[model samples]
Target chain A: MTDVTCFSADCNKSKLFWGLLALGGLVMLSTLSAYFYIEHHGHIVTGMNNQIVWGLPHVFAVFLIVAASGVLNVASIGSVFGKKIYKTRSPLSGLLALTILAGGLAVLVLDLGRSDRIIVAMTHYNFKSIFALNMIFYTGFFAIVGLYLLTLMDRKLKPWSHPVGFLAFLWRLALTTATGSIFGFLVARAGYNSALYAPMFIIYSFAYGLACFLVVQTAMYKWNNIQIDEYVLGRIKNLLAVFVAASLYFTAVLHLTNMYFAKQWDFERFILVEGDTYPMIFWLGQVIVGGIIPLLMIFSPGAAKSPARILIAALLVIVGGHAQMYVTIVGVQAFPLAIFPGYAETSSFFDGVVHPYSPSTLEVMLALGGMATTFLLTTVAVRILKFLPIDKLDQKH
Target chain B: MTASHKPERRDFLKTGAVVAGAAIAPGVLFYGIAQGRAPEEGASSLVRWGMLIDTGKCANGCTACVNACNTENGLSGKTGPQDSQWIRKLNIKHLQTGIEHNLPMLCQHCANPPCVDVCPTGASMKRADGIVLVDRHICIGCRYCMMACPYKARSFVHEPLADQNPDVPRGKGCVEACTFCVQRVDKDQQPACVEACNADGHQAMLFGDLRNPESAIAKAMLAYASVEVRGDLGLNTGVRYQGI
Candidate 1:
């Protein structure tokens, strides 16, 4: 009788929890409705056409996927590197990795033209194609990471955590490499055919993934009315600063390399100065707001000491991440292909003109639905499972 | 009775000779003429279909070829960014030389096609006859092929389609490009653009089997200095242009 009453009490729901769930549910419903509408009508309703095939959904999908691989870094530091504080946070890290990856994949699959014919994609194999290779990598990551999470969560399986954690770490690096190589392998384009894309994406994943982790950790601590240790915060804050700096360095190198090439000068100029909205997205959004402001807040005087300032910096980095993806994916495509190198060419197919694209309401809703999905999954998982970082772990190590 | 039922060696030899002569006669008469396969036969690798275009012979402002392509394929013929263009005419001016040139551009039909290389499914494909095509049956419409195309030849269908040509199979949500008019080519008819060019008395476009030494296109290519546009990429395009 005592157990029965206790179980009933545990089933009670909080007002905040119910409200959060409702918000996520409403957005997801809209996303489903939009998908059906697009499927029924066709891609003509969307901003994407022949010139700009992928749209807002890809930006959101790619960001979530890169961040998902990076979040596992927390768990890797614990099990693989033998860090004590991060060890206490490993369970939460593994959980976030799984849930966030789910959100990213949902957006990608839903945006396909023949979503009903996904089985054909699974059955067909084109080994030479990088896009085909990525399908294998994504599937492998889910299976390997799921097993890694199981080892971290279960006490009986704890003995195998180290080997599994190391495997997951390598697999995560490979997954991000494949993702970056998707752009890098396009030999026809001026914007993407660089060897640096793989390592640059790896670094971006580190920054974006760590930023996501910090925000969630801070919120969870606040919800429980607990004070987080300053030592852990200080170490992680400095680490985030390193990742942000590395990402910026890579971005600078990518542009400078393009500028150095004689044939690429026109493309570089178009992206940096002449092209509409592209230069603003590159300089203002990526360079200024995302890179410099966040760096200043994290390092200037006593700004780093304040937790709020650090959180704001992380948010800025995320916003900047989106800006960078937009410039990379959409901006690169706006420039016309150099069909005739020495000749000025004109045709009825909008050959020399900058291809225009503007995202529709449905696309925006679909992208936001990805984020809401992550949030909803995280919230419910936290409430049901013991995902909060354990106290008194610093002394144990 | 037994002698009536059994045949002699002389009679058997006479019958064999008649059967041999009857079998070999039609084949000898139609050795090259039967190049076009019957409907039941698949595309054969023995033939490599190609085109040779003489830029000098191309008219300055003729839209006949483009119009015929639209009518043949049931395209809307709209020049908007969303519209599909299987063939287009290009007006080019050299940056340094200030020399002007007019020509028609379509699929290059590269031996090492980038579209076929980048497709996740084996839908963007090259036929046995060396004609590059998209198999719309299994295309997931990712458009990676469009991104990879250097010539800007490919187009993705955006809106739902209607009033399609019976000979051509096309629909929305699939990536498509110039197939060198495979539907007409299969029927032993020249591509609509080539036919229109000839009907206009321009005779700028010639389509034939590149492997056949006697083909007019092959002979013209041998006699004149024709060059593939963007030949530096080493795609070995089947479409070659002269007097550019």
Candidate 2:
């Protein structure tokens, strides 16, 4: 590893930094404008109808919330497990977690039909609801992360940071589980009514969060001309391989479990084998390209040590994880359970019986805005604050 | 140092005790508040709003109930199957026996309602009288209740609504279902659909106080064996179908 001086003021001088901030700000304004317009007029502005009550915004919101959990992995590794390699990067990881949380919240607010009544969600708590529990966990997690970051800034408060870090790790795990239970506890809806969703989310959080963190870290290192140790990068590649394998296994088990039960076979087959939109996403996008291809790239001896090849695998894992979330949440609802079987099965796809949905252009723009917000916040923190410890490399074990 | 440290240790213990007490205080206060407001105990005064659907007499093709509900509730034009089905006519056939039955289905208003159980915001709740209504003002549009409902009775207002009946107070980001015409019931009038059913001379749909023995639904329940959908779940649903 080559030693590089802290770019005292150069962090603020990057062209990408300014560009991302401007783009992020513009996106936020546009999303806010759309939200207010819809609020005043009603939900008629969106494409969602009765059968497909949840559409693109719901999918994106859940995706962002899940991704937010993943963004905390590096911090958990460094602070909770006391990993030396990750120590310098802990604050950056915290910043990522915070930014992702904000993005997640924004997507949720925008998805609501009454955006102004969001406060009602807080005031009215249904103790029986896993979704309500998740809201509470989300709030607590944010508060804890804020406190942890503040504690890190004061050298005198360092001794107390470990407990805070431990709590953050435990809280994040709980938060992710709660998010999973939001869907898992739905016993009525065939696609989502399962216990598997909870643990599956936690596993993907580790895989996706680590991949996202590495992408940003690698990009930053390149921009600053900082050299990363071959040993560290090698370890990360190995970790990525394990995460990708686990994620693939979780997904396979979910499908297999549903198939094993003959009664559930109709809905399972409809979504996995027969459905038009679902089969392509489940097989090509999520399973083969997202899972098998990435698994091969990471585990194959020929490609294992190559940094550039490993990054591609990581990217695939992120894309696959995201696609999985969409299919799991949105695709399952596409197949309508007919209350009456004797009547001719109404072809909902052709007839307007089923609501047709594809994200409107503005919905896509809002989702991109969420990602840009994450990037811009992280960039500003790295530039203006001592988020990454510049002196950690020089310290002896 | 020992003498001074003794007072410091006592002070530390006191501080620790106070902090622990503070943490536990909120839980205790919440419990007390819940208990204090507990309703007067007697034979349950809660109105148990229920419906009795006579499948034997239901005219399969006559969509009078659907139209009547749409007109009375001020719902927009019927767009999709799932959006607005306060009363849906279904042709059910048992796969094993090939038994066919034409049934009109709506919110069953279960005593142990799954929708109410899963609502994160308590927006979906059974009134003391057993009518399951969603408080639209409080819903965050999370849609957990929609997934929990066994009959798929709930619908989400995904797009903004216009031309809403000012009395109804519809909003987006909330789950809604048939309230058995709660406003009409409160006014001591029959549900609009029920009125429409009677006016069409079908007499297939019946509404009454389940608690009153002389009511038509109660008399019908006694005369004929009434059936509830998915009765195995034991939700004690208010809506019962006769001769299904």
Candidate 3:
């Protein structure tokens, strides 16, 4: 864990890096302990059960996985779209993609009922399953993105970065499609049946990925006492705003389309107005705090000059991203399946009523582990390598 | 290669004994058939096991079938939110008519099971005889199959189990559902639920091979207006309900 190669002549910079690493390591250890405890005690210890099978861990896992694809958007803009300022941020973007995905994937694998048999899960194939396809897409994205990062960093491989970057871009589109389809393809529940999920998640990644990039980049600048230019900052925030608007539009369409059908009316009411945690999260956490406020902050007069306001806006987007995932994953499962239409059913198996869920402390710890893993790995990698973007006044890609 | 050259004696008497013993040894020999099929034999595709449930004959508040299933599967019989219920008695009412019905709900064993289709490791699989089962040996317990099931028939074991029925294998961390009582079915016997229903004089559930036209369940289904639950899903579920 202490294999840091400091780039600066003064060794004093290494002390802070080591201290942050230790803090991350402590959290990582606690996360692993939670994993082991659940593994030994079984899922009975967790709030999850037959109903609400996926809980808080899934929210964190899916958020990170979906955002990981979005994180690569910075690199894609630089290499494939030929944005010179974005080119400066490509390495950091690529690094974030890997470390964040590792964290998300770790939570998913660790939360499995039979995590020890992960090998068998890989060897076994069910091509009809969207989950299986996502596994392949996730693995391929790592390889292509890793290569894309290498090509962008090495002088000799610079010429090939564009082609690799293009491949990575296409692969991520397929990746996000597969990710969204995990819920969309499911017909057992009313909340996930819409085909709009694929495109909606794609736009969400753009917003989430850009917001993540802005937060990390701003923090890096603040940490190093560097002042980011106003023009470059404005351009990036504008892109983020457009994505947020597109994502919001798709979300409205998804709900409106479902509302058009009488069959989906109950589910719509439950999620948007009737249900307890979901409606509040969807309205306050996702829509207001995540969408409107951030858009206002970004487009506000003199906003580009204030880095703190922009950073807060970006942080809010991340918060809203988690809220969106929570409402999508946990909220959907909390509603019981409509097995018998035109019938009010009740049983010991919880057939007709709304399922209850309360996240246990262990479950919360496990969820935080995914974020901690990303932070720990990112901290070490950034310290060891030169990931800072250099923005010249007349930069050319 | 001549038989006469072998040190061990070869005669028609020994060969005759083998031929005669083969006919009678099914129940007696160590390697012979024990329950319908020999140990090495697989579930036959010639049979598509099914059930026909007449809700009119199923009395409300009766839990004989549910009790029988729990006892047969070695379940704790707890009805908590986290408890595993391979089968349950669902009390449903038609909102338009206000007519109520109580039916024992379990795995429908659909010809096209969504659980089987969505399982990442092919652990939620179907036997040749049309019995949907979880191969716990390979099941990684992702629970994706549970989300795909329209019937909500599946249950994931939440706690470590003990003193399980030797014939019915179950474990924590794997998704499970009704197999039409596969162990009893393999032995050419009716499921415990069907037996309990009959013993209770409800005569509600009829189990037989759907592929065979002369089978009692088939004849009954043909003579009656039996329909598959969630038939709109186009699943062609093996379990049919009558008088709903």
Candidate 4:
């Protein structure tokens, strides 16, 4: 005797839902088609080469994965911090974390050269490799979060929610640390070998995930023809602003640390000034569009209260996160390894030169398909389950 | 009736010979081939396979080593950005001095290879004799090793291959690099590039066991100060260069 009243009463909603589902299905189908083509023809068909091994798909995957960890913060706040306002919203947050992870992981796995050998990847273990350790962290996140979700929804399990939520919170911190270390542990690379990357990634997860949470929360409210109370909206927007500020601080610290090292000067110059797309993306896409614009929308007295503006800010944050990931993952790889320090080196393999990469249609399709999957899964979960928060104050307003 | 029949000595001998020959032939063939093809039962830590390239002896525009590497490794020999190259000739000019030098660059075969350390599946590995190689069977084609190599030595197989050397098996989607011609080295033969360099009369490259004081590579190390590229990293690369 679950309450049917919790779900949307409008039968017309199904038609729109079905249409969205079909669109997601189509996108996923195109992704699969691209995967098959890459498999048959090999990586020669793509923009990837010996020099630029990773490209657009990686940016999408890394962004989604980092944001997935962030999405869980909503539930963590509700149960771990004992915020009653957040507790009502915990189910939706849990659902979102799971869906976003699914989407990100899909892109990562499908992009692998031997995607069919997933069973081998699962079974094999090289303890020294951080990537191997991430597999454990990822699987644990799913199990712990699933149990946490159970405690949130089931009446008998409600007592267990706080403890489970506490574990999930700790689990997510470790998960994000592991994700950051994937780049941080690169001892040879000019850009990545930083101990700072782990915490920076955690802060990034917070901002991106909360922004994602806000956007979805807004969409859900709009769809149900409900409006959240101004107080709750104010609280969430403030939290997002704080997270964004912390991320900005971390970004500044990371750059300052890089600049301090004499050897890293060339790399810093390339990223901050010399490189064409990287510098542009860093200043315009990441700092301006992702950071400053969103802060303006969140903090501006007139705009802060509007749901439309908040949603726009969240969207900008997501876009900016992608740009940052591109600069980090691809841009770093594009810069030549300092193999020959004193001399100008030349080779047929594009040594000592910035490698060029253009995203192929297939790669773009795969990335968009990941976003589609996230949307589709989130919509379906909320439609069938009582994930939406019912704010008494909002109803009264 | 067949069981009851008493066989003649000739028939009995003939039956015995056929049965014995069938059983012994395979064993004899296996032992003979295994003796020729198999590495010593264990790669001795006492032996460290290494290379010393004398840049002073290296000649400009000499394609001998590069060509031989391509032929021996079954590489397409195409120097395109997308093509796989196990070894390449590097032309370097000192920025300040304006002095030019030429040398063949390949996997440095570092004692502590970063590529081996970063590989998720233990596919990138170093043999006991210090020859670093990709276990292509286990390589999931993640290309993380490509990122980790300091020398830019490794290459990902971008396209499907044809006419690959059966002795040196490679597949598309796997990252590969200079194996130091392990197939030839195990049999006390020089790597193809070294042999071709010698044949071309440059004798710029010398390959030998570094552990043996009597070996040419060790004696050369004693006579000349050899430098590992990116020597500050303290990788102790087996491949060293004289007169960088």
Candidate 5:
């Protein structure tokens, strides 16, 4: 067995590391304070109105959950396909999955209007509800991933690790798909009522998951003073490039199909081009900054190999993926379904229609706190538990 | 690894037998409970609560139903356009013909409610006597029921509640809709809104058991063709409208 030592002793001088860690801690404290405030005052503190009941918290939760699903892909490749390149990294990847899952769950729990009675949602199962099914799937997926990570850590249980990994991969996919279907199955809401949402989420999981993995892995390498092999880095960059392009294609297809079908043109146009905040985020932030820019950087021969460019690209992709989620979930609820035509016609666009949705200061703090918790937990796991294997993969191959 | 080598089949059978027994126990217990609680044969005391709204006879200007509901329920007048409405006046129009109709709407209390079908937690359920109510105490506030409700009757108490009626159940983190004034119903009294309409001499709202042939609701159903909104959803709603 190769001996490993703390890389932090020598390579912990990066300002970005300290800045990110402190920022994360600040976010966490603020979120916790906001949660207590909501508990004291009520959900009224947030901007959720009757028409736009779900707000930024739900958007954050879905983004984190989907990203978590994507984070498991490294382990899936290592354990299921026996990929030597990823095997050494599997333990760290598994830990990342668990950490991200916890962060996602925290966001969801805090978003509930009645956070106190969350257990009733579990103890009393609504058999017919897809949302109920999602709850079960999430619980089961977390357990499976957590147990598999444990098995990886214990050498005695290594024999069963492969089977567990395979199961986790399949289970996580199903969980992500189910989450997507929650919106897809809603026939009433113009923005959500679509069959394409499920596949779109699966594609998103891969793109965003790869982006998260690259960002964290690069930071870990630098912090530990370990040189990531140029060959391995190149392969990962290629993979990321492919994923970004695929994501962009899927997004384009979604909008093109929506435009072509014309069933929901009014709502779709408003959201895509005319809606407040959505159009800017979707077209510029998500597509241009999050999608096209990242794709261009990763695919360009001159920039693809540059570590700085790669990191920037990964950051953009992550930002874009989250932007996509916000637009899909939050933007959909912004416009009310004109149920009463006579009243709707008589009244102004805002009258009898709720235009209430602004993420409270506390809501933003809590969301930022959730992100910080994920990073802090991951950092601690890497440092204290030796979750990342130092030299498991030899260059001899 | 060594344990796998010894008596594999015998151990498997033993474990299988135990598992099989555990699986069947719940079914057997449920059957026994059902038999023990079975009502007397040919004895019918079941109440099928329903509502009959006469839109044709109803005076549109009088907000008596709304006022009565607010006063009786001690509503704090905090309800905005975004808030829950136990009873709402909808001004609907035909998509093609542009024919407009003003009608009051509430919980349909469907026999096969989509809200009930989609509630992952049994919080949204129809009572044995046919009243659709939310058990706020057990509700998880996932709001799946809200999305499923065709009438958009359900509302989430998004903030800490204040000035709620003590006798009438209310809270946050739960979906709420019209209870058909279950508190009054238990006392054999009509819903506050229905009573108010009657007192006003408009008598546009009638509350009774649709199953009872002698009930006014049943007679109204026989005399006039009552309509339920989005009946194509096949919910078999308790709330019916006349001249809709």
Candidate 6:
């Protein structure tokens, strides 16, 4: 085991830090521009309609939101699970979680019909609605994680870190559960309406959060020119593989269960084979490239020793997670709701037909803005705060 | 005695005129209220407004109800994928038997509305009188209501609205569905669709208070079996259909 120290001082001023901040700012500006354009011209100028209400923006928002919870797993491992290596990195983990959540929420709020009346959402309460419950859970995550971060960073309050960390861990799990249930509880759709989404989302969070952590950890180390111990990287890579496998397993179960029911035959066929882009995304984007390939790379012989291979796996997992969300959010809506059991129906509203959706330029910009928000905040946070752990590498692996 | 009789006759005529004026004034005022005034503030749960459509009476080529709803609700009736349609005429054909049917579909207005239950801000709500509506003041336009609705009854306002009926205010970015023309209902009149259908002589759509045992709709419901669309979900919808 290596002895670790904490860095309380501001990070050394570097061109790299300024460059990332500048890029983040540019993306955020474009996002704001898109928001204003949509706000002024209305959704009529965009591709979204009555049928496919939730579109590309939702996919990005949910991805960040789910990833935010998963990102905290590192801190949970450190504080709740009592791992020495993870414990030192708890502050950074907490910070990343908070920032990423903020980004996701920004996209969700801006995409609303009355973005100006956000206060109404804050004041109103429908206790039975899962969406309302999610509002509460989301706000609680920030407050709880904020406290956990303080407890970890403040030397005098360090003793309380364990308890605070435990609370944050439980809160995130609940938060992710609520997020998943947003789709699962949708009894109207054929694709969603299953309890499996809750656990599936949790497993997804694990994979996504670990992958994100690896990327950030690698970046910080490379920027500082510090030699990361091969042992540390190996542990994280192995854990990512396990999480990815678990996510794939849950997906299999969900499809298998759907296959068992004859009623789901049409929906399954649409998603698996007949759908326009949905089948391609499900098979190519989600299953093979995103899931199987990443798993193979992670479990390949001597793969853990190479940081590059692990990073590649992390990137693939992220891509796959996004594809999975696209299928879940957009593809589900694209498939028409089954109103009549045995009748072929037609109407002016594109009923009984697959609704086509392609992301607009504005939507893409808005989504990228959410990503930029996370990046900018994370950079500013790490530079000012004592987020990076001081690593003491051992020569012998 | 003759002079007294004359005065008495005159007095009787004046009293009769006064009584006639008093009786007619209320009817005129009610007509005015029906034309322009808003619904009274409180809607009671005692009155469950519902619709029962007799498919046997619905004509295949008739779109009078759809047109009436658009005009009443200030919708364009453009039939674009994104245009607001408070009501639509659906043509359904049985896959196995080759049997065909046509019906008008709108908000089921369930006793347990999924849209209301799923609305994040309580914007999609059912009034005490069982009229489901979106509280536009709070609807963040998330479109979750649209997703939750079994009937593709709801529409999201994609474009800024102009020339809207002052009583029916619509703006961009909010999800809206048929309000059962609560304005007309409050004034003790049938919905615009029902009126138009009756006017067109189709007489397929019947509107009345379901709770009142004596109501025409309730009586008709008793006479013939009515089925709620997707009734197996057990939402207990306020709207019902016959001869499906």
lDDT of 2 at A228: 62
List the candidate numbers ranked by lDDT, top first. Answer: 3, 6, 4, 1, 5, 2
Give the DockQ (2 decimals) of all models: 0.64, 0.24, 0.76, 0.72, 0.24, 0.69
Give candidate 2's error at residue B100 in angstroms: 3.5
Native-to-model Cα distance after best TM-score fit, residue B103 in candidate 6, in Å: 0.6
Over A226-345, each residue of candidate 6 has an lDDT whose tens digit, in order, gives 667777877778899899999999999999999999989899999999998999999898899789999899888888678888889999999998999999999989998888878888
- Which model is ahead, 1 or 2, in terms of DockQ? 1
Off by over 4 Å in 1: A1-13, A391-397, B1-41
Give the Cα error of residue A159 in candidate 3, in Å. Answer: 1.3
Return the DockQ of model 3: 0.76
Ranking of models by TM-score: 4, 3, 6, 1, 2, 5
Off by over 4 Å in 3: A1-12, B1-28
Against the reference, the lDDT scores of all candidates come to 0.86, 0.74, 0.90, 0.88, 0.76, 0.89
Q: After superposition, how far is residue A231 of candidate 4 from its true place, in Å?
A: 1.1
Task: Give candidate 5 misplaced runs (Cα > 4 Å).
Answer: A1-23, A252-263, A338-354, A389-397, B1-46, B81-83, B94-96, B222-226
Q: Give the true-contact fraction for every prediction, in order.
A: 0.82, 0.51, 0.88, 0.70, 0.49, 0.86
Q: Quality of candidate 3's docking, in CAPRI categories?
A: medium
Candidate 5 per-residue lDDT, tens place, B49-130, comes to: 9999988767756767777776666554456634556666666556677766666677888888877877777788888778
Winner by TM-score: 4
Residue A35 C-alpha lDDT in model 2: 68
Off by over 4 Å in 2: A1-12, A301-305, A338-356, A389-397, B1-46, B81-83, B95-99, B158-167, B172-174
* Candidate 1 lDDT, B111-190, residue by residue in tens: 88988998999999999899999998889888889988888888888878988988788877788889888999988899
Off by over 4 Å in 6: A1-13, A392-397, B1-41
Specify the poorest-scoring 10-residue window by lDDT in model 5 chain B.
B36-45
Instruction: Estimate, for each residue in A1-397, the C-alpha lDDT of model 1 and write its tens digit.
Output: 3552324433444556777899989999999888888888878888887778788888898899889889888888888999888888888888888888888888887888777879988899798888888788778878887888788889999999999999989988998998888888877787888999999999999988888898898888777767777677777788888988999999999999999999899899999999999999989988887888888888877754577888898899889888888898899998878888878888898777788999999898888777878988999999988999966844445
lDDT of 2 by residue, A1-397 (tens): 9965556656445556787678778877777776666666555566655556666766666766777787787777778888877766778778888888777777777767666777888888888888788889999988998887776677888876788988999999999999888888776666776889889998888888778777777677766766666556666777877877898889889889988987578778877888758778888878877788987887777554466777788788778876787688667777665443223323212221233467666666555656666766777878788764343444324
| Best candidate (score: DockQ) | 3
The CAPRI classification for model 4 reads as medium
Full-model lDDT, candidate 1: 0.86
